[model samples]
Target: MRVWISGGGGFVGSNIVRAAVDGGHDVLTTAHTFVPPPDAAYAVSKVDMTNGADVRASIDSFDPDLVVHCAIMNDWDRMYADRQASWNAYVNATRHTAQAAIEGVDASYVLVSTDWVFDGTQGGADELTPPNPINLYGTLKLASEMVALEAGGAVARVSGVNGQHLARPSTPRAQDRGFGYFVASIVDSLSANEPFTVWEADDINMVATPSLALECGEIMLAIGEKHGTGVFHCCGADAVTRRDLAELTCDVFDLDADLLDFGPPDPASMLAAPVPYDTSLTTPRTDRILGRTATPVRTLIERFREQYAAQVGEPS
Candidate 1:
């Protein structure tokens, strides 16, 4: 398969790039400002997705059989702070990708979205649940989903992507962070005997980057093969609190879980917009479509340990 991923320099996209190349697919990926270290396996384009012409030209040049639109300004504060930029990147850029895919012969477009699309009023939302976004980020992503679906593309809603980005720098940069950073940061803090804190009140469904990337790759491949498209819930099998996840990480890494401090989430104080408390997604229908079950959260965290070890060159 010839695959193209926007924002491949970022965490989730980097994982997708790694999975695609490891699976023996020809891949082309893009970055806006922070270019990822070179990989012989795939080509990287310096495409700013917020620009329509740039998006179209890049996709046209790649001419991929599968296009995964992963580009977005995901920082909640930034999205709320600069709503226009976020809209351009998340909504306009998505429109460009979907337009390119719709025009490109035999190409399938997949828009990577978030569980934030739902307001989290009810736990365990499924693919059939209506999106009730609460913040700017969620609103834009939901709009992107509509654009993609309207253009006859696929939407894969994911949550809390955590794992190592293989193509990133060995010495971590500020932007080289993901949900996996939570585990990595805690490990580092524990190593230095520094204090660490985990949220006590919130719950989220966290998907390991490797598994999410693989599932997304498979979904894109299936869409290309069958020329089909729709929304799919791709997330971990279970929901866990920050405290539980932190404890599990400490246990997996042989750190002192007793040193961890618990704190309640105050979205109003910490975020520029309202955030979901429990955006757990259930993927039974998606599993049925893909003919596979999601990896358990504990198992995925262990896999994260392996990737984290590789990133830091430490024993797992």
Candidate 2:
């Protein structure tokens, strides 16, 4: 199958590119400022998704069987700080990409959304749950979802997505620094025998069913291949706290847990937007659609360990 993925230089999008190539699909991807390393398996084109003409031209040229839109302003703080840019990236980009996919090639479109669309008060929210986003990020994603759905496309809502940095393994982009990157940072600090401080707060301690980017990529591919439309929750089976995830990373990487200093988040550094306390999603429908259970957190961490080991040329 021919697949076109946007934001190929991003954290989840880069993994999607790798997943598509590994699945033996012809892949064409778009990158903005951060161009990923050139690989013989697939092609990468520098295209700005926020620009309708540029997005349309790229999709028209690729004429793919599937189009997965993953480009967006993913940072919560940044989204709150720069609302217009986020709007352009999320809503405008989705509009342009979905229209191009539908009109240009009639390709199967899948918009990569977030579990943040749900308010944190309700855990295990399903596809049937009416979304009431509390922050700008969620609001924008919800709007983007509407655009994709209106275009008769699928929405794959993933939560707390993290994995190895495929774009620049050595040094990830600022937007790419997520839970997985935090784990890597812990590993680096522990390897140097330096103390690493972890901020613990009511807002930041929200529970989430973390999803591995690689697995999410595969799920997105399956949704596109099946031409499934509607919302699908693609995330881990186990919902956990940030502290639990941090300890698990220490366990999986064989790092000293004592060096992790738990502290309160600095008031100055706290996010401006309201954060959901627990936005974990239920995936029974998604599981049925993919014919597989969502992976647990431990297993996801173990896979991350393998990727980290391979990247660092160390024995796992």
Which residue pairs does candidate 2 place in steric collision? none
Q: How do the predictions measure up, each by TM-score?
A: 0.87, 0.92
- In terms of lDDT, the best-performing candidate is 2
lDDT of 1 by residue, 1-316 (tens): 7888888877778777877887788899887776655435788888888888887888888888888888777666677678788888889999988898678544888898888887767467888889898777778889999999999998987676556655566535221212435666677777678778665544422222223444455555555555558888766787765666678878888888877887754344355356666677788777777776877877876776776676675532
lDDT over C-alpha atoms for residue 196 of model 1: 80
* TM-score of candidate 1 against the unseen true structure: 0.87
lDDT of each: 0.72, 0.82
Worst 10 residues of 2 by lDDT: 172-181
Error of 2 at 306 (Å): 0.6
Query: For residues 228-269, could you state the per-residue lDDT of candidate 2 as single tens digits?
Result: 889899888988876787788889888889988877765765
